[model samples]
Target: MGNYQSGDNTIQGERLSRREAVFDKMDDDSFALFYAGRRKYSSGESLFPFAVNKDFYYLTGIEQEGSSLLLSKRGGECREFLFIDPYEESKRRFYGKKLSIDEAKRLTGIPNVLLSTYLTSRLDRLLRQGLDGEEPVKKGYFDYSPELKIGPELDVKTFVNSLKVVYPDLHDLDARPLVMPLRKCKSDSEVEEIKKAAGYAKEGLLSAYSVLRPGAYLYDLGLFYEHAANSASSCSGLCHLTHIASGEEACYRDPFPGQKQAKEGEIVLLDVGAKSGQYGASICRSVPVSGRYTPHQALIYKIVLNCLRAMENLARPLISLKRINEFALDYLACECLREGLLPSKEAIYSIAYPNMVCELGLDCPEDYGELTLEEGDVIALYPGLYLSGEATAIKLKDVYLVTERGCRRLSDADIEIEDIERRFALQSK
Candidate 1:
C-alpha cells in the first residue's frame, strides 16, 4: 500500500498511499482540494520563488505553481485528480516549462491529470451534477485557514463564497482536520528528508562555530552558517536565513542577524534551520564567545541544558506536550531556586517575572501543546531560561521523534558545553 507502483502509466507509491489514507477518513460525498500556490509577485513583475504548499506537497509530491490536487470519495469509489499549468513558449524561455501531463501522472500517481484552465469548470461540474455514476459532491474540504488570510489564485474564502452563492447547499470544511493527523507522524521517507536537513544543519552549526572569535559578530556567524548549509544541501539555495541572537535576544529568536559584535564575556546564538525535500531541521545553540563560559554563564547554561535533557527523557509516547512543557518549566524553577536565582519556585510562573524562564518562542507555545505525544510523532522541543536580572538568556531547541520508550533528538550536532569549548579551542589554533 505504501511503496508500490501499479501499471506502466502510473507510479502509485508514497504520495498515492497518503491520499488514499486521507480518503478513508472522508465522507462518501466529500471532496478535498489542495492548492500548490502560485509564484507571488513582490513588485513590478519581480516574482518570489515558488514554495509549494506543504499539504499539497505532502499529498502529490509535486512542487510547481498553478497546480492543485483534488481528491474525492463518492459512491464507495475514490478519485484523484492533479491540475498543472499548461506549457507556454514565453514561460519556458523565462522560467521553465511546466510539468507535462505524463510527468504529473508519473509523479503524483493521479491518473486524471488536467490543465489549470479546466480546473474551475471541472469542479463546478462535479459539485453540480453526479459524474461517473456517483452522487454530486455535497461537502468539501479545503487546505484553508481564515487566520492565514492569504490570497492564492484559488483563495479558499473567495472560492467558497462564490461557489456557495451558486450552490447554497454546498458544505465547506477545513482539510486540516482530515490531513493533519496523517502528517503528525513522520513517514520513513519524511524522516529521511528531515534527517538530511539535520545533517546540513549540523554542518552549518559547526561551520559557524569554527569561525567564532572574540571579534566575530552575529552577522558573521549567520553568513557562515547559511553558506555551509546551502553548500551541504542537495538543492541550491535551500537554506534560508539563519537566526542568530545574542544576550537576551536568544530567547526571542531574532531572524535578522546584524553587526552585533561579540564581547569577551557575552554569549552568541547560532539558531540554524536547514531544509531537504521541504522538510526542515531547526537547531538552536547559544555559546560563550570567549570559548569557555563564565561561572555565572555556565550556571544558567547548565540549568537550561539540564532542563533540555530532562525534557528529552520525558518525551515518551502518550505524554501530553503541555505536560512536557510544564515538567521542563517546573524543573527549571526548582533548579533556579536551588541556585538562588529565583526566590521561590512559584516565581517562575509569576506574571511579573515573565522572563524567569524563557518563553518557548520557537516551539510555538500554544500550537500543539494540548496534543499527546504518540509513537512516530515528530515534534519540536525548545527548553530555555531567561535571567532578567543577569541580562542574559539561554535556550536549546531540537526536533524529536516520539517513540514507544522515549524521544530521540533529531540533530546530531555536538552541542554540549565541553564540545562547544573544545571546538572553539581547536578552531582558534
Candidate 2:
C-alpha cells in the first residue's frame, strides 16, 4: 500500500481518472455498477463492521456502507452517478454520521449524486427508455466474485448481479478485467501507503515482545498484536486477522491460534498485518519461546530465510509471480537437499503444495502466471516449512515491491538469533 489515497485534494482527481479509465475500456451503450457491500452479522445483536468493496472504493474513494457507483456511456452521452444511503437524523444520532450526498459529490468528484432508493428505478428507467434520444444500455459490468455460489435466494447479490434475473438479454461482463490491471500495478501514492502499513505491522510485531516470554498464551499474544497494530495504525485496526501460533499449531495451518501455551523450546509463528488507509501488509516471523534459537531451529530458520531471499534477489519488473515461484522452489529444494532434509531437488515439489511462496494468492487473480508484473507491484513472500519428523514449522513472511533492479523489500521482519539472545540476555542479567 503506497501512501493512502486520502486527505489529499488530488485523490479525487485520481478516483476520477480511474472511473474514466473504466469508461474508456467500455463499449458505447455500456454501463458499469460497483457496490459498497452491506455488513454481515455474526450472531444475535452483533455484526461485522462494514468494509467497502475494493473496486467501488477505487473509483469513488468512499468507504460508507451500501453506497454505489454507476458509470454509463449510453446513447451519445457519458454519465457518472453516485448513489448513497439517504441521510436519516435518527441513524446519524445513533450510529454517527454517514456520508451525505454533498460529501460524496465532493469526495468522488461525481456530480450526479442520488439516494440509494433511486438506484433500481433509475437503472430500470435507463434500460427501458434511452435518455437524450439515444439507445438503451445493452451491456453491463459488475464485480462478481468466483466464489459466489449460484443459489436460489440471489438475495445478497450486488444490485448489478441481480440485473440478470430482471433482464436476461443484457450482456453482463466481468468488471475485474477492466480494473485489476490498474489495481495490480499500484500508484506511487499506493506504494507509500503499503510501506506505511508494513512499517506499522512491524511495529505491532515488535511491540508483542513486551508480552513474548515463556508460558504466554498464543491467544493472548494475538490480542496483544491486534491492540498494538491498531494503535500503530492510528486506530484504523487490522486489515485482516493476525495468525499467532506456537508449538504444534505452528507446525501446521490453524486458522485460529488459541490457548496453546508457549514453552522454552518451541517456536512461535506470527503472520501479522495492519492497515494504513485501505492498504495492509503481511509479514511473518518465527521466533523461539526461550528468546534464543536452538541449533535445529536456527537451521530451519536460515533455510526459510534463504527461500525468501531468493524472491528478493530474483523478482523484477515484467516477470510474473509464477516465474519467481519457480526460482524460489528451486532455491528451497536445493537448500533442503544440501541439509539432507531431502534427497533431490525434484522431491521438493512433493511437499511444495502446502509449503510454497505464492504472493499472487494475496492480491491478484488465481491465474496470475501469465500476468506480467510492473514496477510498483507489491507482493508477499511467505515460505513455510513443516517438518513433521521434528514436530515444528519454520516460516518467514515479507512484502516486496517489484522494481527494475529486483524485489525491493517493503517489510523485512527479521527474527535474528543474535537479536533474540541479546534481548533475553539483558533480562537474565
Candidate 3:
C-alpha cells in the first residue's frame, strides 16, 4: 500500500507486521534492516511504526522505525537490542504516533532498548574497539535493495562508503539469498493466511462476474475485486496492479490495459489477486460479457482449462516446479495441435521450446522451477490460450495445493466456462 493515510484510514490496531512476525523467529546473530523514515499519507506525512523487511519480520515480530535488531550469542546471554526513536511530541506531530523507546521494547518483547540517536556513536565504538589497529574485520550484513535504488538520488552509496571509513572492516552480505531460501516455504500460519486470500480471490472473481455486462470499463471491475479484498481486512490493496483485458486487448499477454470498455460478445479476462496482511494469492477467470462464449471462445477456454487440469492432476509432493512447468508447456502445445488450431505437433513444440522465438507470439516455458508440490504448498497455475494475432483469448488461473491423496484448488471459484455462462444468463434475466 502507498504510505498514504487518509481520514477513512485507520491503523486497525498494530498487529505484528509480517517483518516482526518473521524476525521474532530468527536465530541470534541474525540482523535485519528496519525502516526509519517519514512516509506520505493521504492526509499528509506520517512515520511508520516501522515496516520491517518481510524476512526480518518473519523472525522478530518487532515493528518500529529507527529500530535495529542486533542478535548475538555472547557471554552466554542472547542479546536482542532494539534501538528506537525517543518519545517526542514534536516528532509525533511530524511523523504520527510512534512507539516510544520503552513502548517499542515492550511491543517487540525484547528487553534491551537504546535511543536511536546513539546508533552512530555505538557503531563507532564497536568499530574502534574491534579494529584495535589490527587487520580490519571482514564481514558485515545489510539490506541493499533500497540503498541501490535510492543511491543515485540520495547519495546513499556515499553514505554507505562513509560508514566503511568509520569501520574499515566491512564486508557486505546480501540478504536476498539468505532469506529467500526460507521465505519460499510458508509456515502453517502463513499458508493459512494465503488460503484465506485465495478464497477471497475466488469470491471477488464471482463478484466481478455478476457485474459483467457489455459496456463496463476495466477499472470499474478492478474496483469490485479490491472491494472484496478489503472486506476481509485492511489488506494492502494488491501487491501488483489489476489486469482486466477485453476485446482486441485480450491478446496482450497481461490483462492490464488502456481504459477500453467491453463490447458486445467480447470475452473479458480479469486477472486479479489480493494481498491480505502482506501474503498474496492470484486468480484469473475469463468470461463472455454477453453471457455466452462463441465457439472460438469456447475452444480457447477449453484448451486453457484442460492444460490447467493437467497441471493439477500431476502436481504432487516433491515434484520439481521446473518439471511441472515443462509439463504445462507440452500439454498446451499438444492441445494446440490436437485441436487443429496449429497445423503440426512438431511446429507447436518447436515454437514452444526455450530459446526459440515463437513466431506466433506464443512464448512457451512460461515460468521456471521444478518445485515439487508438497503438502501445504501454494502455487499459482495460469494456463492461457491465444492465437498469435487474434483478438480472442482465454486464460484461467488458480492457486492450488498438493495433498496426500490428490490436489485441492485453494482458489475456490466457479471455474467452468459453462457455469459462467449459466450464471451470467441468470443474472441478465
Per-residue accuracy of model 1 over 1-429 as CA lDDT, tens digit each: 123366532324666767878999888888888887776667886867776677787888787877888887777777777888897777788778778898887777677898988888878877888556446777998877543223444466887888899988899988877766677776666677777887898888888887777777788888888888888995534434667867656545454677777777878777677888777777778888888989888988888888888888888888877677678778888998998888888887531222211111112221332567778776667666765456576767787777789988777787788988888888888
| Winner on lDDT (2 vs 3) | 2
Q: Taking the tens digit of each residue's C-alpha lDDT, what string does model 3 give over 77-192?
A: 33445667677788777667867765664455556677877766645544454213432334444555452221113433455578788667665555445445445544556666
Which regions in candidate 1 have their CA more than 4 angstroms from the true location? Answer: 1-12, 133-135, 146-154, 236-241, 251-255, 349-369
Global Cα lDDT for candidate 3: 0.59
Candidate 3 matches the true fold with a TM-score of: 0.77
Which window of 10 residues has the lowest lDDT sum in candidate 3?
Answer: 356-365
Off by over 4 Å in 3: 1-52, 62-67, 73-78, 90-94, 130-138, 146-159, 346-375, 402-406
Backbone clash numbers for all candidates listed: 0, 11, 31
Please, what are the lDDT tens digits per residue for candidate 2 over residues 97-126? 988787877787788899998988778866
Is 1 or 3 the stronger prediction by TM-score?
1
TM-score of 1: 0.90
What C-alpha lDDT do the candidate models reach, one value each? 0.73, 0.73, 0.59
User: Each prediction's Cα RMSD?
Assistant: 3.8, 4.0, 7.9
